[model samples]
Target chain A: MKQDSCQVTVIDRKRIELARKQMPGAEVLENVSEVLKLLGDTTRLRILLALATTELCVCDLAALLEMTSSAISHQLRLLRARGIVKYRKEGKIVYYSLDDPQVQSLIKVSMDQIG
Target chain B: MKQDSCQVTVIDRKRIELARKQMPGAEVLENVSEVLKLLGDTTRLRILLALATTELCVCDLAALLEMTSSAISHQLRLLRARGIVKYRKEGKIVYYSLDDPQVQSLIKVSMDQIG
Candidate 1:
């Protein structure tokens, strides 16, 4: 009742303050959430997992995922937009890899945890 | 033309084989995606971030996030089902924290990557 009635209900100020102080800024939190959300997709995640191990051209990714190069390229475009994956152009081939080293850690850590 | 007409178009067999070899099993990838999906929500992620720093009860989380205990409990249930966070009952209070160490790493690694 008190909690409902009160404009401000402080259950544990220490925790409130602690969580507040340690909380990453709003932008960072938003970016982190966005990154996680983007990583949440199955096909995209599969591509990332593959790239985490080594660089892959669209055709290679398509072969590995049993999909088409066009399909793989579409998802890779989304990943590239989010800055999660980057590509290198060598002649007519474009190879993609995880843009951030910490991304590999994120995947490895999450996979290890799941295992 | 060659790629489209053929059911199997091998761009670079070596890269595909390497990716397939390094790819995690299907279940692990699914679970990892599920975990990341669970973590993709803002409220759930905020709760996890708080717990990553220290343990907190539903009341504490609600108060800190400025939400009702019932709302906090609902999200906590989802998080619990996914095993991203765990809780212990003490008296009338239930304290929650991240279930897996690598979850902390996942968050930390992502945050670092974003930075």
Candidate 2:
């Protein structure tokens, strides 16, 4: 029984080591978690989904979302900090769009799969 | 000036409507947010990442993660509720594995893009 248990322990250890190796980033997992967390909010996810299709300014997003510009701005800040969205200013308007194509692809694929 | 302002308002309303139409699930968005929120934690994300590679029992995951089995069990419960992971009981052990192929694919794509 002791010998059998030792062998099982060794196998478990090996399996874990293999999992760690395949995962690659113990460091970036937090960043990934944060990004996923940001997407976890329905409003934020909808905002990202909208932005993925085209660039839009705060006022437009607010009008479309039926939300205040302040709410839209706050969500955009979170998305921007994670490098998920990018924006450019023109006069008094700031236009926001997805910074990474992967993000857009992710949103598209997830939405399709879910539907 | 009134005519010009009306044109701008119409354009803004049109843009908002377009955003709403493109994103189909105002209903399921909440569920998606919940799933994403569940995946938002580093430990849970790691647990999912580890499970993505192979089927692992709670004890093995705890050992590998250097966390308590209780903690691993809690995380697994969330993942299971989200339908992200599935398990089967055999004798005294319950083996857990990724339930959805799309989930595995998403993880692979995201990891690759990040790296």
What TM-score goes with each of the models? 0.81, 0.84
Candidate 2 lDDT over residue span B17-115, tens digit each? 677788766677876677768767889888888887788888787776767778889888888887889999988788899997776676666566553
Top DockQ model:
1
Model 1: residues with Cα > 4 Å off, grouped in runs: A1-10, A90-92, B1-8, B90-93
Query: B9, model 2: CA deviation in Å?
Result: 8.4
Error of 2 at B5 (Å): 19
DockQ of 1: 0.52
Task: Score chain A of each prediction against the true chain A by TM-score and list the results.
Answer: 0.77, 0.77
TM-score of predicted chain B versus true chain B for each candidate: 0.77, 0.80
Please give, for residues A1-115, the per-residue lDDT of candidate 1 as tens digits. 2363224355566876898788887787887887788788889999998987788888777777888778888888888998789999999888898986666677776777664
True contacts kept of 1: 0.56
DockQ of each: 0.52, 0.40
Classified by CAPRI criteria, candidate 1 counts as medium
Judged by lDDT against the true structure, how good is candidate 1? Answer: 0.80
Per-residue lDDT value at B108 in model 1 = 74
